[model samples]
Target chain A: MAMLDVTPQANGTAPQAARKPRSHARMAWTAFMAILRRDIVVTARDFIPFLLQVLVQPLFFLFIFGKVLPNLANSGTSSGFGNTFTVLLLPGIVALTSFTTALQGVTLPLVLDLGFAREIDDRLQSPLPVSLVAVEKVVFAAMRGIIGGTVIFPLAYLILGNSFQVRTDAIPQLIGTLVLVAMAGATVGLTIGTLVKPEQISLLFALILTPLLFTGCTYYNWSGLSSIKWFQIVTLFNPLTYGSEGLRKFMMPPITVTTPAGPQSFTIPTLDAQWIFLGLGVAIVAFFLIGLQTFRRRVVS
Target chain B: MAQLTDNAIEVIDLVKHYPKAPVNAVDGVSFTARRGEIFGLLGPNGAGKTTTIGVLTTSVVPTSGKALIMGHDVTADPIGTKQLIAIVPQQSNLDRSLRARDILTFHAAYHGVPRRERNARADALLAEMGLADRAKEKLTRYSGGMGQRLMIARALMHSPAVLFLDEPTNNLDPQSRLFLWERIQQMNREGLTILLTTHDMLEADQLCQRIAIMDHGKVLALDTPDELKKIIPGGTSLELRVALPQPALVSATGTAREESGLLTALRALPGADKVDEIAADPNDPAQEGITRYRLYGQDAGTLTAPALQAVSANGGELRDLHLARPSLEDVFIYLTGRNLR
Candidate 1:
């Protein structure tokens, strides 16, 4: 019984015609592109809901902090900090929105994919290595971050009007920061998705991410914590802090406000771009490796 | 022309002992499924059928030994082997976000089928699976049967050399089961080497050219359905129920088969080769004093009259007498002494 030598195909018409042989690299690349394309098509069909999902929180924050609070603060003793606050807040909002958008982009879909039904099997069946599938998730999520970041600019302008100033120089540095921040956000999202139980997702936000976002230095410059030296060091633990500081380094210009007294400089200090990129690069690599390990355990078993 | 090795799947002493498992899930299982034949792994749940399919599909790594698909080692060359095989797993793993047409097309794309060829094949498979009209429908709207057909269509997208169906019709209605059975036969006829796992004895009997009957992580019997039935001394059996000689008034219900000597007499009959005295279930009071014995022979017809004569000669009253054609179920019971799992 171990040896079956019967020629069952002797007279059987070959079910498949001979396929053209493809190189291993070519097949893997094709499968990767297919998964990416499928994700894009799915996202495009529900683009409005997607936009609502990632944009709602950031937009609400932008309106409340960038417009309402600063205006209210102007009527109070903290008068000078209003417009200067919104100016620095613009770049920080861009950073956090991009980071959180990318994070949610990967984590939400992965909850369904790795749930009991394991819908991920549909793609895992493809002729690609296990790690490549996780890579695809990160790549697609990064694209969403880029889109969220781009869309935030126009929306921020509408909220702050002339207060949203950008000396949009260091074009290459800005681009690099955008890519690095998006990648960091996505890899962290991947890690959470694979490691946490689906039911723990909501709790993860309420506990881990919300507090992290609050301390990420998105509403204020990282250097503004010089008075609270402990928080100055503590905020660095948040990956979103590096992203916010990185975007601020390249995007924010020194604020100049002309008042009844005279023109005054409103200084909002930012961390150096070099240090921010270094921290972000390390986090992305570390989370990517961790995500890959967790993803393989959850999928292949 | 010299014949190349045409076995589509070769599993050699494959074993998978999951970490912390008390026993190996698949213990030294080995079999070669010849090309274009419908081969079956018939076993109950937890009998290692799914694990074996996992090993073959490269989803479950073996703890020891090896499995190959068309000579590509599963562990060493999963990508290459995966290119030649497609699996329809027990659970529905369909991408619920995509339309049925997109599901097929995306599957083709994943297999590296070129863009021009993808749509054509997807449409063709949909039409063949009787899902052409609902090609644009969302998966949420699909019935279980329709979804199963869609899975079948998706698996065929790559025109794979080997197709693995892990309990293919597990939860489908009978109508769907029959439809899928016909589809499997058609695919096998057209020269696709098909390996399916099913606990359905009728399914194995009706569909497979050969079957491996597994129990407790081992293949207990492996042969064609007819050949397996021949494991019992009779391809047919005389299923006889007879009342035994009266015991003492105090011991009336129990010990009587030894007193009657009918078991030995039945075994000594002209055509009968084997006899088993079935112990009446003590838990069931309905079978109180009657003893049942099965007389197995090459031809059960020849044993009926002689068995009745022997019973009468032994002063035992015949209760029921019928010739039973042995089934794979009987063979399983004969081999394992347990039914189902």
Candidate 2:
């Protein structure tokens, strides 16, 4: 018979002197930072593709609607329409850029990680609560959203030369609105990323994203929608509408037009800055809690 | 200072049931591995070996029961338990986007290895696993064997007290398998306790200090390989090939000549305890005019003469004879009434 000879060795090797266990707070912090840094490095290495994903659609929108259409229709400084349209379109592009970049950042990789690739298993095994992994993903997505906004802001100006302007007085509001919008983008990304199945991802573009873009107050302001009563009520539920309106109020120049009734000024109606900030803060907390719960359940089970 | 425990792993009646599955993946399984020993859980696929490892590693939660790693309950203190052990899962779960060196470095960082030592340890581990040359390559470009080696290197980043390998050699070539085996043995000698799961009996025999044979979600047997092999009916076997004519008649000496008569005579021989006729294919050309018999007992040499004579007297021509030692495969067949793989 083929014999298996395995003699048990003495357990006599002196165990290394036991060291004090690190405090839970310190360990958790270390693990969290490590995960965050890894994600940032991976994103940085593949930056070109990431940059392209963030810039492509916004660039096309700025070129076509903000520049080409206005010039082609012969509506420029002479008609006062070209500059008005550019002011309206620039903020919309920034909001859309932040929204889509954050959404794709979290959802695309999440679907792949949770589905066939299972690359997330390594992160799941870290010595931290599983919920923290989901939070780290949100943090990274939010950072990407902010980066997307910064990249697109300069590109918007390049595309709509001399049409778009940033008022020095509104700079603080612009910065605050951008930060809140990025946070909202990340929280929404986290929720949708965890809730949707890989197979159902295409449906997200059709059912969720299409509606968000059309009703998102990108081409029109919330006050302009008041002329259409039902739409004014309906668009309130779309989170992107608030983001677009907030950017419009903070980043664009005031619209002035030449009319039969002398020089008339039109200001797009927007929610109070306090209300926008409050709404975004509430959304961030709500989606984060929901995403964390769903992520924890999926990972543990 | 806390004292070290002798047992590296202790699983107690662990059970894991998928929410909608008909049966438990792991059903009331229990075992222990002493510190500094390489223990194996041997089973065919779907025999709960991976599930057992999953629960012990805290990747999969158990429905009930408890598992302790290095004296910390996995459920009660999962992070503490996770800090104490590392696993090389069966699948290639490494981040494909990261370079080979980055994979190891990231693992070390996650496990709280000091930042100053992380790069040096990653280089040393890659070198030890024979992967230093390819350390800068992306994981997407790695071969299956290379990926498996990287996984092993990554798992050792923390210098874990216990290491779990779930079918580490599943798809490895012979040379790679042997290399991995040697590396595993070296790690064990250096005082790392290992718990590995594999269906290959020979692998378990070669690497395990003790094994728990599992089947159908439960452990069927647990012992050293030598002792498990001894559980078979007899330690040795005698195989005999006899040529017989169609519509066979009695032997030339006029004694009984059927398969039953031959089996009885073989059993009556000294040192022969159990005798059986092995079934053969009726359509096989090589076996068309032959009969095969197997006798299980202590010594085949002593029974060789009488066995051949018995066949000849029964009007059958003695074609071939051989004595063989029973293997772990035979023992598994005897225990489960099925093949191990």
Residue B320, candidate 1: C-alpha displacement in angstroms: 9.0
Clashing pairs in 1: none
TM-score of predicted chain A against the true chain A, for each candidate: 0.91, 0.89
Q: For candidate 2, give the docking quality class from DockQ.
A: acceptable
Candidate 2: list runs displaced more than 4 Å: A1-20, A74-79, A199-201, A227-234, B1-3, B237-323
Residues A34-59 of candidate 1: C-alpha lDDT, one tens digit per residue: 99999999999999998887778778
Best by TM-score: 1
Tell me how far the alpha carbon of residue B8 in candidate 2 is from the true structure, in angstroms, after superposition: 0.6
Query: What's the TM-score of every candidate structure?
Result: 0.87, 0.85
Instruction: Categorize the docking of model 1.
Output: acceptable
Off by over 4 Å in 1: A1-17, A257-261, B1-3, B238-323
- Per-residue C-alpha lDDT of model 2 across residues B182-288, encoded as one tens digit per residue: 87887798788999999888899999999999988898888888898887666887789987644544455433246667777777888887676765566679987
Q: Which ten residues in a row have the lowest lDDT in candidate 2 chain B?
A: B248-257
Model 1 chain B TM at 0.82
